[model samples]
Target: MIRTGDEYRESLNDGRQIWINGERVDDPCNHPQFKPVIDIRARIYDMQHDPETQGAMTYEEQGERFAIGLRLPYEQQDWQDKRDAVDLVMNDIGGVVTRVGDETIGEMWSLWDGKDILNEIDPRFATNIERHIHQCIKDDPFHVSANTDPKGDRSKAPQDQDPDMLVHVVRETDAGIVIRGAKYETAAAYSNQAFLKPTIANWGNDKLSDYALGCIVHMNAPGVKHICRTGFAGRAPEADYPLSNRVDEIDTLMILDDVLVPWEDVLFYQHTRAASFIRTTLHRYSAFPFVQRTLSYADLIIGAALWNVKQTGLDKQQAVQEKLSELAIWREGINAFLTASVATAEKSPNGLLMPNQSLLMSSRVHALTNLPHMMHLARELCGGQICVTPDAATFAAPDTKPWMDKFYSINEEWVADDRRKLLGLARDLLNSDYAGHRLTFQLFAQSPPFAQLAAVYRNFDWQGPLEFSHKAAGLSDNVWGKGTRH
Candidate 1:
């Protein structure tokens, strides 16, 4: 059941429609923009089979090996194992990349927990989700998510401006339901499938809507066009933009032009409640891994900032130490949330163990809400040299090499080349275009800031606080009996 790197590489040759920078990608695995990340993803697959990493990255059941990341959780160890696997990958890769597979599979599990809603809406497609969960375990396909349609104008109704702005069931056919719309999906060009569904939380209490549909979208299926944002890999020298070149997860504005979702692939159809249910609980299980990625990212940021200070001998300053403490506070805040979430893990309605919702969601808010500030803090610690530093070419030019060496070299231990490498890493991690794009990705990847807060509001135990306040204030018995309000 386990796949090798070559099998993953060959799987993308399914003639999927992929476009980037106005050019059709003939081979995404070898395309300059996608090749770096594709290779990273392939390496993750290979790591599962490598004797050194196979033990950590995979699990054996009945003498057959399978991806640990794809295993369905039933106990707390399942989650801890997944966490260790993600950490191993981050360490091995030497940087961070999100939307691989583990991060997005939680969306599917969220829906699986809503099977009762699925069954209520349409009995025919109820079992589709359970089947696919097992399919992922068996085939080890790369999965991603599809939500957030480009609702052209929020002021006008979907029908008034353009119905296609939201993905909807155009019509039901003998083969399946035909869908037309576009979604901004990260890694869609390279991923095998996406759990396509609605992102709008408010469905106006309507019973059935064409917009309320969920299905499994095959990336290579007919009419699926992956028009990707221009990638950062080949745009600059790897020496100057190492993280950008190595870990950029390309996003696609995936267009579904009347794509068919066979009955077997449809998870829910024309049911607003199902859509609402999914929109509310989509990140329940996935937020753990999503937040975990932020933890690795925090480490990278902290390392860059600390090393920059150490390079300039500024770490000894009390003021500089204060700034480093602030960064650590943010880092450990994320760490605490993740650790506590796992320790107090809860079971899903369907029997799968998931991280505690309150801590997990609040962790997402804390991590993302303060991300820009923390990134800016790290940026300050790194100093202005990161932004003003020239590319690797200037440092290597024959005439400028001596001058560059004189200015960049710090001491006996830190030479010009090493200094340039550190500055390059700091620049790419904090100040580059890729850095800004990634910041935005983390901000809204799971959902928007407002939605993230809403999740926290929904999951948090407000009753406990209210009860405590009520007791402290010596509220009347009448009010104490009511849940949150009299």
Candidate 2:
């Protein structure tokens, strides 16, 4: 069933424990740090009912409406509709948000594509996956992902050191398995559920171990505790820090202290191969939406810089134009990869259409690897004025209003108020604490750089280059390894 904004808000009051800044949070819907982003999520829900946006935000099947983001992809049009829905939501909210439901739901689809592997362990596991995928469509609950574990020491194994460092099944009850560990999850505080799974690990030759697990975790379950990191919202003035105030998604150190996972919620367990398969293929479908967020961020940065250069009359300079061209080239490079991946979409093992892995992984690398450089270029284009500009209160003060107006006003068309607004946006986008968090989130949110490159290495067609070199060089058949990827 489709949920409205009020239903989504009311769902959060289901006796979930939340903590921020060392104080217990009674209600996230009204808390300062959580309210702004919560309202954005609620607005997204309300969009599905609005006359103007309901078309793009939802789809009808058998005369009933459901969220388009939760719809299973059977064709390319489904993907396009999902893309259009995400774009509409970001535009409606006026900023970028990464961890709402759509981006993480594809992770479950990835695991679903590995049903045969899961079936080999237990047919019930595969059936559980199938049931949950549809159940999400029926429930319309806000789902997030939980992957990274605290993993106390790299050199010591879970058996040797603190076993709780990595999430493991303590024992199996008649009801389910009891799990004890913690995961770093984004948006877990206010989210309804999380697709919990293991991080990359050295499974060696073991096929069955306690460390291998995947399940659906209810956010308000008995032993789940959300120890949230300090939020950027309400700590600073919104007038000077706009994006931080509105769009910062609060992350959490979600402590799963002897939590019980019922048999119905368990997707897979005690199977190293299943864990390895999921670790490899987890982001195959999800990266599309994740990379799309980068594209929107590119537009925000470019718009900020273009406005800044225009205000300073630097748009006329050839050198300034070259810098802007560089930003555009990087932005379009991301766009090209995203477009081409879908143009040559591949069918998954389970018959779901997935973006081309090679192009998608390459796009993620291109978007993230050069993000710091692109951010620096945009910072240069926005100029030093973003840093030196006075805050909103300083501009409003009677003692300084005249001098601020005289210096900041560029022409009859440009005034102090507009100039300061632009500077605030530019600073928040490129120079603020939120900017650093955003950059880090892109860098390692999905996985680290080496893992991303490994994905490209695994998916790229090495045989094409190998065969081409063998024919071009007229090498013997024995030299090329007979169509095998190197």
Candidate 3:
């Protein structure tokens, strides 16, 4: 079920309504803002069929080939294979791009892990979740996630202010259920489908409500409008903003205006318990890929900073090397967490292998909470030249060519062109508008910092410390509360 690059490209022309910068996008594959990242996604698909990378990207199951990214994890090797495929794609594309497919597909697996909770509501709902998880492998469709709602007012309930503030079932028909609301989704405009669910956990004391719903939403469905934020690709020259031009994944405020979701597509509905279960465990598997992207980002910043220092001979200084060590320590901290989590992977309720929850959640917080400070460290290491660099055109112009060469050229090995290029990369990674957006995305993409801590709180074994302290203080077991986190 592996599709070629052309097939993936042609699939986006499914008459989906998409708008960017107050103008309609006719062909997302050709539109300037989307074309760059769309082409990157297409390249990833092509890598599956390419002779050089086909072995790494696709696996044969029952003599039928399927994408490795879409495969369900039953053993540890499955996770390793997925990790290798992501690394190969990032290396091939020369930058990091999340939400391509592998990252979002895991959200479905998370829901499948909660089949027991879903079965309590309706046995049919559990079956629907299972079928859709396998369908991703069978059809190889590009998937994304939709969880956050507009949520107009925090003080008022959704019913009080505007019912549409949260995505909910408006009416049920024989064919399907009609929904009205919007979700803030990244890459929804060009993606094939999204795993639509609720964002807020507190659904009052009601057992059933329209807001407690989940389903698979086709991106091109009628009444689904993709209103994307302005993209960074065409906003600047590639030489000055290479990462922004090539790897910016456009975020969209997807408007689901009375969209009809078929019966078979509904994973759960009218059950607040199901919504609560999903909201808590939504990123159980997807967090691996999400955090892995930040690992790649760390490499980007570290490499840029290290190269800048090397070009200027600051690498020989002990003081400069200390700052570089801090970056490496932070980078390796993430690497250690990811590596250990996979090594100690746990089996899910449905028997799928999940990264060690405590380590993975802690790693997510570690990667996100300190991302801004790490970026500042890299920026400081790179020094002031990253901001004052001349554009590529200015360097190439006859009037400035000789002066640029005389000043920028450090040594025979360190030419002016390479120095300028390195500075440009550093600027884009640390000092540009695109850099700020990327930092924010890392901070809140999966959930907010508090939510990440809550996941750690729920997963970590608190009893170990409580029991240890009790013994140390000669206190009785009754002092530490009963039923403490089995």
Candidate 4:
């Protein structure tokens, strides 16, 4: 049931009551701010059906074909296949932020829902999983992972926050449960079909027990509301600002007021312990796939930066060449880790192929450490021209054309307009609100950078390495002791 890009686009025409700012959006499909992101996601759907990418997106199992995404079990080939799929989509969208937009979240939610059924307390959960998966494959619906709660204070639990800050179950019935509160900083909520799993493990506590609820709901459901930020997409014309024109996936704040979730849609409820399990498990599963995406994004940025350097006549300078070399090194480092993780993938007990845990953990840590540095390096290499470049309108202005031509022309190689366009694109990458949003996303996607490093340290097989060192030094014969570290 692989969906085509057109099929995916048509699905969004469903009557979903999504709001931007205070107004109820009558048609999200026609919304200026949301249309570009929808188009970007549609491109991802198109990738699955594309001749070149079909191999990466679909896999054969039991003589039946299925479109594989980041959620597939850890088969040996699955890691690289998923990476290739991610690259195809990211490159088409022109960056990494869109990679997080809707496709990834939908795939992730489908995976978690499927896993919940197989690992369930009730047999009926399996039916729910099957039903959900079928719906996803057929509709290719967009979704947002509403996992982070708005904690009033960093040190306190969800109960300590204003009750409205965390979505929680307020009433239970034989049919379902009613919930109220909000999920903060949710990306692409306006374009999604439903939000999956609002509370992650960190917020679990006795006082916050109801907040541990998990479920899925249609965006148009009663009592559900979405508040979006001022997006770059809606800011200006593409002719004047090319970067923000075609790629703003609006981030949002979602509020639920007595929202009812049917029993069929509830993955977990009042199971606070399961919240932590879900977080750890999802982190283990998603780490490497994300690295694959970020690395691909870095690769594109590196290419663009190098080209900008050449266009600016700075490529011949030793300092500039050295900076480009560093960008290359960073790119290679990310790629190496991605390759290692894929090569080391193993089959999960559920028959899903996933990335190697150790390598995946390392990749996440490396991304936290390296992405900002890499982007900063890109900005440095491109220089002040990225920020000071004139808009397209100014370049086309008759009065400014001659002076603009003389000053921007470099070495009689690239045309003044060409240089202006390149620098404008670079500015979009480095100086625009889009750039700021990307940095924010990179910094907060999983958790705080320190927390990510801690998870890596926690999951790392340090004792195994230590044992190998000891054995090599003839200090010990036992390597089994390392297994108990976790």
Candidate 5:
């Protein structure tokens, strides 16, 4: 069933232990730091019911509605529908906000695709994944991902280091398994649930290990404490750092202090092979929405840069036009990757449609590896005004008002207020502390740069290149014995 904004807000008042800036948040929906983000997420939930967006954001089956984003994609159209739903949410919100629900929900679908691997470990585990995927559709809950664990010493084994560094099963009881450790999760404090799993890939050939486990974790569960990073929202006026104060997806260092995970919620446990399999394919479907966010973000960058140049009449200059074109090129490159990945989408082993793995993987690498450069390019286009501009308060003060207006007003077309607002947006998007954190989030949120490239390495068909080069260079057939490239 589709939820309204109020319902989503009320859901957060479940007495979850959430701390930010040394204070526990009594009501996250009203807290200055979390309110803006929570409101945005609520609006997204409401969008599924709004007449204008209802068609795009949800699907009806037998008189019951479900969030399109949570639907398991079985065909190309299902994927396109999900893509359209994400675009609809972003457009309605007027800014890019990841981890609201859509992007992270696909992580569960990726696990669902590994049902066979899970079945080998435990049949019930496979069933659990399926049930949870359907539950998300039915409940329309806000879900986030939890992968990164604070590994105290990367060189030492989890057992050797502080055992609490990584989340693990400490003991099992009739009710559930008690787990200990922490995870760095975005939007965990405000969200309903998280698909918790291991971050470590190498399980040391051990068949059973406490670290090799996956489960669903309710944010308000006993012993689940959310110590969030200080949010950017409300730190500055929304008029100045618009995106920062409105759509910042707050990150949380979620401490699982001997939290109990019910047997029904456990997807997998003590099976290194299952953990290894999940690590390899965790982002197969999720990366599509995650990278799609970059596309929306690119639009924001391009729009800001282009509007800045237009206001100053720099659009007529050849050099300025060239830079604008460069931004467009990067923007469209991401667009093409997203479009083509779906166009050439492939079927998963579980018969679900997945964006073409090779194209999607390469696109993720392309989008992330060059984000800093793209942001820099846009920053250069915005010029020095974005950094040197005065705050809204300074622009409005009695003593400085006239001077600020005289300096900021560019022409009849660009008034002082409009110019100030534009610079504010550009600054927050490209120069603010929140901007830097956003860059870091894009780079490492999914995984480190090396791991992104590794995904490409694993998915890419090397045989085609090897075959072409081998044949082109007149290599003997005996040198590299092989059949035709698959």
Candidate 6:
């Protein structure tokens, strides 16, 4: 059965051992730092049942209904349906950077593990994957995909790094395997049902026995610890900062100490090649959809920025209009790339349809580069008003209202109190820790951006383009070039 928003909320009471700062949290479902994410995810769950969104979020299969999440079969129609569903959810959220775990990364992890079934791995792995898919359909379990270890140095392998920095197999038993280490910069750890497949990359030959493993474990599994980052959203009084307060409330670090994974939860073990394949496929397929979602996110950001500009009476300024225009262009570019990818999607060898890898990669590249630029444009458009805006409390204060009313008002139409409200929101976007979190999210999402660009170059079929250009030149010989371009 598809879980409703309330059901989803109830499920979060599973007692996961999550820590923020120094103390362990008793109930993240109600905790200020984590509740907003839970609420956002609940709304996504409710969307599956919403009349207008039901068509896009739920589909029928084998005489049963399934949510258009991970359970949606990888087919042309299914892909479109999922795409529509993602856009609908993103649009409702007004493009704030919600944690990625609830749908995007969770579904991607499940799908990536499902790919292994195609390789004819042990029957147990395939069975586990199938069961996981059904569970996702029913509840759309919140999850965090942990692939990056806290590698102490850039020039080192997993084994070369301190063992504590890399999650690895500590012991193998007939029942399951034990692992210990940590995954850094994990988002939404406190609210997720499980952590899926730590580090999907292939461990080189020497490190295969240790690093090359994949599995899913309950968030509250024994010995699991969560450490969250202090962020802008969790600290502020909601009355003073309404919008930013509800977004980005669950970014965290996952620490695993001798965590045991049952045999059924293990997707791949000692199969370095398969691990590499899964990672590549997951990154190629999942990352692109996120890029597509960012189009809608960008739309919201642009709208909010423009709204703030208009509120501040700067909309008429030529300089501000130019920045808004650039923001619009960036959004349009993302939308165009998303449309192109969907239009040209192809089926995988396993008969599951996926976006065109090359085109999607290009989209991700653009998104990674342009997200920061979008934020910069927003900041520039806001100008000095972002900092000058008084807090909500100041507007509400008895003595300050009269003085604030005379000088701080932005336009004749809006009273000083009203203008302060709008400016407070603008301040939330431009001057608060919320703004810092946005920057951090964009950077982390596409961290080491050059590496992603390199991956795109490597994975993309350069021959097709090069051959076309060569043919255009009427050359009999094929020539290729090295290195990636911006």
Query: Candidate 6: lDDT of 81?
Result: 74
Most lDDT-accurate candidate: 2
Estimated TM-score per prediction? 0.98, 0.99, 0.98, 0.87, 0.97, 0.88
- Pairs of residues at least 3 apart in sequence or in different chains that clash in candidate 1: none
> lDDT of each model, Cα atoms only?
0.91, 0.93, 0.91, 0.67, 0.90, 0.67
- List the pairs of residues colliding in candidate 2: none
lDDT, residue 391, candidate 3: 93
- Lowest summed lDDT over 10 consecutive residues: which window, candidate 2? 477-486
RMSD of 5: 1.5
| Cα-lDDT of candidate 2 | 0.93
Could you tell me the lDDT of residue 419 within candidate 3? Answer: 89
- Model 1 compared with the native: what TM-score? 0.98
Q: Which predicted model would earn the best TM-score?
A: 2
Question: Per-residue lDDT for 1-486 in model 1, tens only?
Answer: 888889999999999999888999999999989999999999999999999999999999999999999989899889889999999999999999998998888888999999888888777666999899989998999999996888888876676778899888889999999999999899999989999988683457678888888899999999999999999997899999999999999999999999999999999988788888899999999999999999999999999999989988999999999999998999899999999998998989998998999999999999998899989999898888898988899999999999999999989999999989999999999999999999999998988999999998889888888889989998998887785652
Better of 1 and 6 by TM-score: 1
Q: Which stretches of candidate 1 lie over 4 Å from their true place?
A: 481-486
Candidate 6 segments whose C-alpha is farther than 4 A from its true place: 62-64, 95-97, 100-123, 154-156, 185-188, 198-207, 311-314, 410-412, 472-486
Tens digits of lDDT, candidate 5, 5-60:
99999999999999999998899988999999889988988888888889988999
Count of clashes, each model: 0, 0, 0, 7, 0, 0
Question: Candidate 5: which pairs clash?
Answer: none
